[model samples]
Target: MYATFPDLLRLLFVPALAWAAYHDLRVRRVPNELWYPFAALGLALLAWEYVLVERTSLFLVRAAVSLLVIPLAYLFWFVGGFGGADFKAFCVVALLYPTYPSYYLADLALPLVRTQLGVFSVTVVTNAMLASLGYPLALGLRNALAGVVSKLMFVGRPVAVRQLAAAHGSLLETPEGFSRGGLDLDALRMYLRWRGVTLGRLLAQPERYRDPATVPAETNDPGDGSVTTEPIPDPASEPAPREDADEYDDPWGAARFLDDIDSTAYGTTPRKLREGLDVITSQERVWITPGVPFIVPLFVGLLLALTAGDLLFALMRLIGLV
Candidate 1:
């Protein structure tokens, strides 16, 4: 679809909401002031899409759904981890994003993630529909043709006995050209040729196959049998325990995790007083936020929109009007 004014408005709300959610998920809190960017963007888009455009009919419908849904989504959140900011965010989005295309009825409204997660469960039925009406089996047809061709081939006459004997015995000869020397029969057997092919030298001539290059270093069984096939190092296999995985590489990481930001910051690397803009811009410790999910006030204005959208979506589905 074209990047209409409405679509452009919707795009404004995504990045800030995504960032807010990232921090909220990380630190369990979102800063109170962080909601401004999202609010400003969303309001601007809403004005453009709703006030300046011709989506008035859809607008009226969403307004009504908004009144009914705004309360319920917040209720579910307040009693749980969902905070006020997240609740409000959902409410705003419900009024905006979900208004497009009457999303509830469209065949492609939901994507694969939703489909896997049990939204619009017609997936299996669709696949079965294809299977029942699709092409006939291919394997049985191809094999039947091969069998017919094999039966039509003529057999050739047998060769002389001496020629056959030499073909079979040529595999055992090697350099020193001595017919063999200090022969390790195991290596010889391992390298044996088949179908008149030398099996790549060693199989053809064990006498010449003793070099380290030709005979892989590993193929040489350990002298004292100290290493009797130390299980093939499979790349798919888990590696031997990592050295750093067990070591305490970070001197202060553990302390930071348990302490609050202010407490941890006291012990953090102090800012360098260098006149050249200090070696680093800032080095706040992770103990408090450790990352963003661990941060507190884990709510953003858009969260309210997501839930409001979800519930608005669910209720619409219930009434078959979404």
Candidate 2:
């Protein structure tokens, strides 16, 4: 049996999304350039479909779907729920498949389930969200089996301070308390490298560096207090205000390093760094959440959206809602 134009177009997403998922998993980044060709192809296909379609009403529905998805994707990104790459991917998907593609395997129709809405991208987003729930569930189960019974078990796992640098995640435990916005480990490593000290070295004698005034000088300094040879910005003349300064004197000794680096570049802030350092230096084990990128689930969601239709819609139907 010959495949339809829409079917061929839909198949294109399989490899494209697979590559994106792999890239996101490996580096947690997806270059904007990767989507350029796909975007162009999608626009061309949409134009071609517009010129060839006999049903004006159906064409309008497709156009509406594409229009609706753009802002929705942007909103997700704006609220920090989705990354910029994830937003671009959804936009490309909207352009490519505004409605569910009509595909078949021999005598069987693909997407065994269907929804009245028929917006393919929305289905993909929903399916991806549902699939992402598995991460927490798996974490919870693993923690349970390991005899750990804490609410945090569902979100994070404990890692030794020495291994924290190599781990891929954000710090959940902090000196102050628990934080929803976990500290960025990459930022911590960046700061450590800037200081010419290893995590182990810092933890071995945290008290030695507890007072920023007495902390050892940076290795990169020329000992003449010159900024010419400095790798990063010079540390601030005065450290950031410490809430507990009167109670405890720079417990982590990390306050002096905050102003020296660009926090935005590392996706962290001074407060997070200060608190995270206190936890890292003072404790042997810390909790960290494996920050899974959304693209992975987006890929799985796309596959399920194409093969099984909207899982949520099917669930609603099973419960006789539609």
- The candidate that wins on lDDT is 2
RMSD of 2: 6.2
The 0-to-1 C-alpha lDDT of every candidate, in the order given, reads: 0.32, 0.73
lDDT of 2 at 20: 87
Model 1, residue 287: C-alpha shift (Å):
22
Off by over 4 Å in 2: 208-267
Q: lDDT tens string, model 2, 1-322?
A: 4467766866876898899889777666777898888788778877777777634787768568766888988997887776778889888888877767777778878788878877777888899999999989999999999998887999998888898756766899777677767777766666655555566766886654454554445432312111122344443332433334444444444555555544452456667777787788878788898777888888999899888999999999999999
Model 1 lDDT tens row, 175-200 = 22222111222112212211111223
Could you tell me how far off, in angstroms, the CA of residue 146 lies in candidate 1 after the best superposition?
51
| Cα displacement (Å) at residue 253, model 1 | 30
| Model 1 vs truth, CA RMSD | 26.6
